[model samples]
Target: AFVAALIAGEKAAFHEWEAAPYFEGCLPVEVMAERGPETLRHGPLKPFGLTDPHAPERKPYAVVQLRQDNKLGTLFNMVGFQTKLKHGEQLRVFRTIPGLQHAEFARLGGVHRNTFLNSPKLLDASLRLAAMPRLRFSGQITGCEGYVESAAIGLLAGRFAAAERLGEPIALPPATTAHGALLNHITGGHVDAIEAGPRSFQPMNVNFGLFPPLAEGIRRAGAARTLAKKQALSARALGDLEIWIGRHPAAAAE
Candidate 1:
């Protein structure tokens, strides 16, 4: 839904809305922006002096607007005139009008500077640096895209690390389990390696794809059904984890 803003704003996706936004309601932002900065503000955002032209209606110098973009769309994003301008520029230019001059930034404008390593080239199955087995990484830094994906990596890293410290021959979670899928993605998915401080890792949350499906293909169901599936998987995983722990507890009381 917000991808249009994300791209148009360049590094300023969220901040593009500091003032009123442009209209990308029917067209692509890239296409809209090509029409010129004011074109969008006037068209999509044209403050038609319509709200109350006779009542000292304050017309917007120009407008930045937003519109619904998807079928199941419950979200909206700013359209055209995306920029890489400084934070001050947005406040000054966007805030130049009547309604928005004092409009506070809702999401704030900013930039994204992403980095990654060639995980396949440096780490082993447990996410330990092959050259420094004592260290492990989890979360987004490991290269899983979403928040849930990252948390799954953290869970597995903890399990594998605990088992290793206990001096017990370790066994992986059943490949047909939630914990197992997460571990599988991290130990050998799309991650590269961290060349700098091992502490420079990212963060994330968890979800179903991280788990193996239920016996009857339950996860594909709608909202209520998916929620039910997650609850069941959590209970099953916790019980299995306890068993694994009993046989090979963490040596350091972690």
Candidate 2:
């Protein structure tokens, strides 16, 4: 009943909201709900790995996980609960979770409109604004997706700035490494598809597709081929990353 109500709940902006496109990676809960009754169950709410202590024999159909919002652990936030429902509706809906019947929210959920830059066109190799080298950009604002990717960019930016301050050569990470692959993607890897226009360079999560292929003779036979290929890539990436790190001994000190 709770899931059904959430699915049927009145969203704050019914008309204008429908016209705006949603990023595939962060689709709203109600938007997912509209796909089918079981879409949410299979996607965000899937209960494949978790084992309930009190009901070990019976598998859970769905699960909702809350995350820590602060360092003190006194505040918790729902993990994938982004929504546009009214405050009253949000409280009524979220309180339906098993252990959260009496849950008190420190902050009711809300949505924000986010804007990001087209980094490839606007930023240089070291992530400085091309037209204004005095400024540098990193993280999602520069178009790299996810926490890890954003942090990697931040680390690179810091290193580049430090190298400039110390009068050292700023060595870019090798394209084979994860950091390099992502940096390359945001800088120049993804060319806009003429037909798709701006959508061609849609935000992306790091994956093997972004990495350059393995060496010529590293092929494996039959069932082992796929896993073997991945292993080769991982090994190569790590080795290249080590070499890149070694070149920046000044960065190693910090």
Candidate 3:
């Protein structure tokens, strides 16, 4: 019903004026609904670990989580509910959710554009601009998505700059680690298409897909294989990260 409402309300809520490419990590609810009925169920509305007290045996198809927004506990936030729907349409559509029929909203959700650079084309491994090495870029501006990724890039940029200033060698983390994988992604992971006029580099969150394939292939098949692969990757990443830390005592101290 929620997905249906979003699709139906899209015509009234969304129009030409608001059309723009959205960050994949933070897609609008209406846009997600347009993809498929199960998209939201698996993405934002996933009911993985919850039970209805009124009817314990019957499992809920989806769930909406409200996060406390203020100290008073009067205001609550709708988790992962960012939307491009017009104000009236948002009210009309969102009310379709169970238990929100009489809910009063302190504020409505809206979408905004995120600005990012094509880091792979512009920046070096140390995050210094290739054309003008004096200037260094970091954070979301350098095309790494999320708060932690931005901070990690900032830390690396700072370390690199400090090393240069002190006449010390700038050490890079191994690619197996999350920081290294993300850094590689930002600096030179993207491959430009042969037919492309401009590089299609985009901001990305650090994910297992960004990491290199395992050194040794997993022989097992099915869910067990997937689990084993993840465990192996995690163990390898941790071991590599520890070695990297040991090699760079100054960075480890920080």
Supply candidate 2's per-residue lDDT for 56: 91
Q: lDDT: which is higher, 1 or 3?
A: 3
| Candidate 2, 1-254: lDDT as tens digits | 86688887777875664565667667778778888888888877888888979989989988887678789999987877778888888888888878888988888766655567778888899999999998999888888778998999999999999998999999898899999998998887557666756554556678889999876655578769878888889998897787677865665445
After superposition, which runs of candidate 1 have C-alpha atoms over 4 Å from their true positions?
Answer: 1-85, 92-108, 131-135, 145-166, 171-179, 190-205, 218-228, 247-254
Candidate 1 per-residue lDDT over residues 181-205, each given as its tens digit:
5566555544334566343222223
Index of the highest-TM-score prediction: 3
Model 2: residues >4 Å from true position, as ranges?
14-20, 53-55, 70-74, 194-200, 216-227, 247-254
Expressed as tens digits, the lDDT of each residue in 128-211 for candidate 3 is 999999999889899989999899999989989999999999889889889999999999967786575645788899988878
Which model scores highest in lDDT? Answer: 3
- Give the higher-TM-score candidate: 1 or 2: 2
